[model samples]
Target: MAFRCQRDSYAREFTTSVVACCPAELQTDAGGKKEVLRGFHVVLEDTLLFPEGGGQPDDRGTINDIPVLRVTRRGAQADHFTQTPLSPGSQVQVQVDWERRFDHMQQHSGQHLITAVADHLFGLKTTSWELGRLRSIIELDSPSVTAEQVAAIEQSVNEKIRNRLPVTVRELSLDDPEVEQVRGRGLPDDHAGPIRVITIEGVDSNMCCGTHVSNLSDLQVIKILGTEKGKKNKTNLMFLAGNRVLKWMERSHGTEKALTTLLKCGAEEHVEAVKKLQNSIKLLQKEEPSLLQFHSLTSTWISCLFPLSRKEGDSEFMNIIANEIGSEETLLLLTVGDEKGAGLFLLSGPAEAVETLGPRVAEILEGKGAGKKGRFQGKATKMSRRAEVQALLQDYVSTQSAEE
Candidate 1:
């Protein structure tokens, strides 16, 4: 516990004896799902690697140049999962990735400062937090946090960081009287033995298991990007600290520059420019429907009077045809379909001929329809029957013409 509470954020290199090495231990798939990993897990006698716990990710490093693929804790043991197993009796040099470890320290410590300040200033409690790879998040108990409020909190957080307050780690016995007075959510239910708490001098103290920098100055800076609605009236604040803030700013500026060039406008004018472009597109779409039509061509069916077999059209097209062929002994069969699904069918001609053959043609085509006067229209699920229906219509017309 004393070694862990030391001020150093990085243990560059250390020699440790392997307590045990399992050739094959049943572990779960690393894909964050429930599946057997077949054989995985390594236990070292003593180590400085911090496994994934307390919302802070695991420390990734090398054990004698062999990559520590993953690290997870089972009870108090920090299991160093690796592909190359070191024998139990062998001693190997271990190295923790200081860059990654230090980043997490910044994020974890930044969260502590922000949470404490938020509670003190606005009465908003920190219910939960996440140390994300790209940016960290702190979930507040309030349902809403306005931009101005967040700005206020952000300003205070940086002010505390600029103060360069000392961050101290302490180990207190379970019976310690000061443990209850610590400003935090509370201790874990199963927590036992000495409690590990992080105290920011003159600011806040939190019961935490994650590593942190020795001073608030090590945080460099904390920037609150935005807020999102969380479960049960919670507002999650997205933020970045240390070098991450600079990297995020770099990326955002690059994107804005590109958008300005492409939109042919200043960064401040991008929104209005985009809105105008969208309105132009909407107007073009409104004009396209009237231009698409199924022009008619004559065929050998019925003097092509009503012109059988016209191109596909919508209900408006059918209306246009109906109005144009008024009171004429015209024969027109209209069919329309798209992407080869069900089709629409229409046959209009002399009242006697249409009334006589429309229903029969529909039955032959395996379609559903009704005829009134000299027009018939219906829906056909099996459009492949179009040819057969046409042939039957021609045959019926021939038979009727012969009798007449």
Candidate 2:
């Protein structure tokens, strides 16, 4: 079936009626693919269901109680594929889901708003648009938009929406003077027949094929999410409109509330609280050496009080003490804790010592680590005994040093 562009000539308020219905029999050819022969027919004096074209999704709704699964253009005719076949000459009422229809209208109209704004404000023409999940994006003939320019354009679009300008759709022949008056040079000159011109009153006028709102106010809001570089000399802009903007705000505020509670701060104080927490962490890191040195003495004196077989909780303290000692000689420090397991640090007299003994110690501890120059650090997953690690380190140091 050949594709036909219908929105250009069709009015926004129209409905389709079923013309014929019959059991569509399937026939297979050489390829064995089933092809339905004249399944059903729909004839509408006019239709509001915009046929799939211009990168827009088709309108969805039930017709004569049968769901319209898909809509396609067949030459000058618009074909509506229904779930169930309808009787021939049945006067079925078509109902378009206005909410869904209006959303597409809002987004399509918003594209015009932004595109027109871009041309007027920056002399850049919008080359294309792709309506997306989070936001609709428009591609401009430029590579980038200055932050200030984007802000100004966004402000202008919202202002237009706020003004509630009447959006008038005019159908004119190719030679219409009104077409020449507001025609965008970028529009193809070869486009034949009547061109649908959407005029935003005194704000904008351009040739468009997609469905649009009757008024600017229908958009409610126009938000510029962001911009990115597209193809050569093209910039893509992401934006949202109406319900999408409201939904985004709701989700964003909910996230902020969750973050505020987790940070233990009020909504307004969240940023400051996060900054303070980061600063406190930095201060503790700087004071770790002195603090660990003091704690090491307590651990040594209370060695009997503590277990000869350390648990996971004690591994962190052991690592701190090892780091505090900061030895120049080859040092192997190991600490075992119940919950956290064991931590091991191997420091070498020279870079060569680590290369020789590091992998061997890792294998003994059932761990993994790699280092160069002078030090190797890693954690053993679950070491049951401190003596096991101590004996392995001693054996490696004695034998390996002798060989060197």
Candidate 3:
């Protein structure tokens, strides 16, 4: 049996009797937090809320004022997941998310038009397609799609939209001869009831079970954004239809304006200005090695930590500075840069002192390390707190001296 949603794509509200309702759990990750939601799996005699299928997401709506979290097709039935349960045989009003539903209709119908036009003009078949939240992709069974082909296909689809082509849907039996004329991959294994076919007046016809707009004018507009290389020598065509195109344009224009302000140049010069800044950065990077230096902190400790403020050097550079200083009786603290920002640190000296103080110094620097014998080495962060490490070593040395 055809659901109310599939029968009338424009219908947003309907009253139906609950066939059954059972305890259910829905796992959700809203706002990046994952949790299992306790809910009811509601089965209505008929539903206007389309389930997740045909590459389109499920419709979000309300059943008797309770938010419908998800909908899935179970054979011939549409299962609506809701937080509250409805009594079996009880009447309830269902409402669909019209904005979301209409957006999907535009994209799905637009795909039909594009696939038809492409096949008619270039014999390029659409292997698959995705109706993404931001944009849609149609994967064509071809190595690459040229700019000229994209422009042509885009022009043709939009022209048909302007022409106000009438889109009609009808259901037929599996053995119906007319079914062979429509374009389709095949019916799903779990598909029940008659096969639904969508046809564009004087354009093309295809078998699809998803909801769609009744007229091409409802699509508003179609924009082929660009193409991407797909796996296995296929070309994925990315596009936007209806409101998505407007949203994309708004975001792109805002980005251009922001770039113009940041670069202090006109829109056209923004590219050159950014390139020049990149070149300047490269030159600075080349001069970074000369910043390294070695020195000692007080007579109580020898410090090889340097290029103290240099951000360009890494741990290997710090190791070289320590090598230059050689072994010594006094405590040694070597760092390529400050841990508060980034870099590496190494501490070496008396065996017992190194063992006791290594972990403490690592904690102070906000980094982890392992040490044994007379040497403690590890990557460190927040090196700006190196003063605390020095103070700790000085106090330990003073304590030992007083004991002796």
Question: How do all models score by TM-score?
Answer: 0.67, 0.60, 0.70
Ranking by lDDT: 3, 1, 2
Local lDDT at 209 for model 1:
78
Clash pairs (backbone) in predicted model 3: 338-383, 339-381, 339-382, 339-383, 340-382, 340-383
How well is each residue in 70-177 modelled by candidate 2, as lDDT tens digits? 565555556676647766555666767667777777888898899888889989788778877568999988878888989999999999988989988777776777
Q: Clashing residue pairs, candidate 1? A: none
List, residue by residue over 49-118, the lDDT tens digit for candidate 1.
Answer: 7877678998888888888867876655667888777788889888888888889999999999999888
Question: For model 2, what is the alpha-carbon lDDT of residue 342?
Answer: 56
lDDT of 3 by residue, 1-404 (tens): 79999999999898999999999999999899999999999999999999988778889999988999999999999889998889999999999999999999999999999999888889899999999999999999999989999999999999999999899999999899999888899988999999999999999989998999999999999999999899999999998899888888999999999999877789999887777666545644554454322233433343222223345455444444445543545466766564447666777767777788899989988888888767787867778888788788778777776776
lDDT of 2 at 213: 81
Better of 1 and 2 by TM-score: 1
Clashes of 3: 6
Which stretches in model 2 have alpha-carbon errors above 4 Å?
1-16, 20-45, 184-193, 269-404
Model 1 misplacement above 4 A = 2-7, 24-39, 189-192, 290-404
Model 1 clashing-pair count: 0
Descending-TM-score candidate ranking: 3, 1, 2
